[model samples]
Target: MAGLVRWDGFSADPRRTEVAGVRASDGDRETAVEALREAYADGRLDRTEFDRRSQAALSATLLGEFAPLLQDLEAPAPAALSVRDEAVRRYRRETRDARNAVLTVGTMTTGIWGATSVFNGDVYFFWPIFPILGVGVGWLMQVVNRGQRIEHHERRIARRLGRRRDADREDDGDA
Candidate 1:
């Protein structure tokens, strides 16, 4: 009666209250093993220590067992940010290239027009508009394409996250 706790007519077991005593799943063991691998790769653990810890990780049956194996190691960086950053950098580079293309075309057309007017001492026609419009339209297309690419990238990331969430839910259900 002293240690008993009831919820909706169901008694809670005191022995199950500690999370550290929980059993580790295969996935947890894999994660600990991966961390050990990273630590070894980062030179935090030598070959012999890595091999020993790796064996321990594979043979571990409780979450508490992984504590010693990963205690000295730093967590690996998240992969999502690196991928997103690279995509953003590529987009920015493409945007800069598009802007440069427009600027170059505009400058060349204006230069040709100015030289013609200076040499002839008369303005015959607005012939530069054709090339400007042509290049402008092409650049516009590139901008539109870039926007689409960004949208596509966003959708792809969303889909990937969705899949990951679904996978996590499935794992939870199994647990």
Candidate 2:
């Protein structure tokens, strides 16, 4: 139990002592259960054993409880560059956020401009155009850099995974 690694394969349990019990998060339990499910699907465990392990994973309250449940199973290596689905979704979401910001600024500025012209006897000044143009330039730049931005996103993921593997190796050495 000294060097027990989590299902994520990146970190080790710091201690196995009763006084130093590390509490498990809901995410920890879910990860353990997911690993168990994969093992069950691969026929590595029989139905009864799978059910028992899955239940234990779900009910676990401490990090130590999870170590034993997944000690024998291997963690899957994350794909280095296959962030297509998530990366695209994130990219689209980012673009939407920028669009929303632009829309909000444009609407507010235009309304203010209209109010000033009507109620203050001010001359018609299309001042909203300046701010809108500024934000619009940023949005245009983002769209133009779409491919490089996506590639950069993918590389960040790949680098994180590479670091995880290195950490796992160091943990194994400690064990």
Candidate 3:
């Protein structure tokens, strides 16, 4: 009767708290190994400790067994640019390119027109306006598109903020 204790929903043993027999994926092992490498690089772990932990991580079968190797270390944050930041950067680049295209097109068209008039001994026709018009229309389209993109990103940010506020309200209700 002592050994046949009634098992409840929760376990008293700390070891029993961990999920047993849950296999670690290759990605999980790689992440743990990478963390160990970073710990070594940051002088948190020496060469021998890094090697030992890395080996353990690579050879680990269960997810539970891998925890001890990286328990003391903090996971490194992802080194990715945020979507909004990247969008802003792309918008800036497109604006710059549009401006440069306009400048180049204007200069070339004006130069060709001037040279033709000079050679013909008559400054009568202003045919450069055609190419300039074409380039101007294209540049105008780019500006409009850029504006729309900025507005879209702004709306998306606002929606994200709204969602966060809603989540906070839900959390407060729970509390």
lDDT winner among the candidates? 2
User: Residue by residue across 72-135, what tens digits does model 3's lDDT show?
Assistant: 7653344244657645655665576677787888899899989988999999578878877887
Estimate, for each residue in 1-175, the C-alpha lDDT of model 1 and write its tens digit: 1111111111211123464567777776766676676567556789999999999979977766766666566534544355466455546655766677778887898889889998999976878788778877876776778767666666665675576577669769999
Q: What is candidate 2's local distance difference test score?
A: 0.70
Clash count list over all predictions: 0, 0, 0
Give the winner by TM-score: 2
Q: What overall lDDT goes with each candidate model? A: 0.64, 0.70, 0.64
**Model 2 reaches what TM-score against the true structure?**
0.51
lDDT of 2 by residue, 40-151 (tens): 6545679899999999978978877876777776533444325675466557666766887789889999999999898989769798999998998878777888997777
Reference-based TM-score, model 1: 0.38
* TM values, all candidates: 0.38, 0.51, 0.39
The residue pairs found clashing in candidate 1 are none
Would you list the clashing residue pairs of candidate 3? none
What's the CA RMSD of model 3 in angstroms?
17.6
As a whole number from 0 to 100, the lDDT of residue 97 in candidate 1 is: 66
Candidate structures ordered by TM-score, highest first: 2, 3, 1
